[model samples]
Target: NAGVIQTPRHKVTGKGQEATLWCEPISGHSAVFWYRQTIVQGLEFLTYFRNQAPIDDSGMPKERFSAQMPNQSHSTLKIQSTQPQDSAVYLCASGRDRGDTQYFGPGTRLLVL
Candidate 1:
């Protein structure tokens, strides 16, 4: 029961550089979700994985956002050519099933310069 862990709680990136965020979900949880929280967008769903397979990614930006669940316990969100508009809190959550309540991590806050 290590809970969810997200690295570098805060990040600053150049206007056109790559930004990578990491998340380690709770053990035994099979569903992982990514979301972007902003003052304007509220909570924008990014993507999700179930049993290490991508279930949906319709909420991700078409240009530079991508997410991967390489294994059971960890996932990553990568942004290429980051821009000011990308500045937001990236959150990771996990649940036992699709309809179960998700537990959220502290989130990684990104600031694009």
Candidate 2:
């Protein structure tokens, strides 16, 4: 509900295709969630959620990227029309609550060709 980042650690897709990444937060720790992207520019915030309700996704590209927390156990990040620049390590992290201890998962490495 709060934290878990997913999809694939290494995802290779062709340009103009679509890609969906998933994350599963730890059980009983679904109060706050956030996603980050690790690219050449360094890590950047992507989105955040509370109680599975979207709070902020302003970091995502308005045109092609979207994220969702459909349930308490998992979340997803979907990219429409994949592009070469979309390549990066997408991270998933969650916490029991805002300002609480957070845990991180292995990033899903996306390589758009």
Q: Name the top lDDT candidate.
A: 1
Q: Tens digits of per-residue lDDT for model 2 on 1-113?
A: 43355657788999999999888888877554545565466877788778899988878889999989899888888999998988888888888887898788888988899
lDDT of each: 0.94, 0.80
**Cα lDDT tens digits for candidate 1, 1-113:** 76899987999999999999999999999999999999998999999999999999999988999899999979999999999999999999999988899999999999999
> After superposition, which runs of candidate 1 have C-alpha atoms over 4 Å from their true positions?
none
Give the 10-residue window scoring lowest on summed lDDT in candidate 2: 30-39
> Residue pairs in steric clash, candidate 1?
none
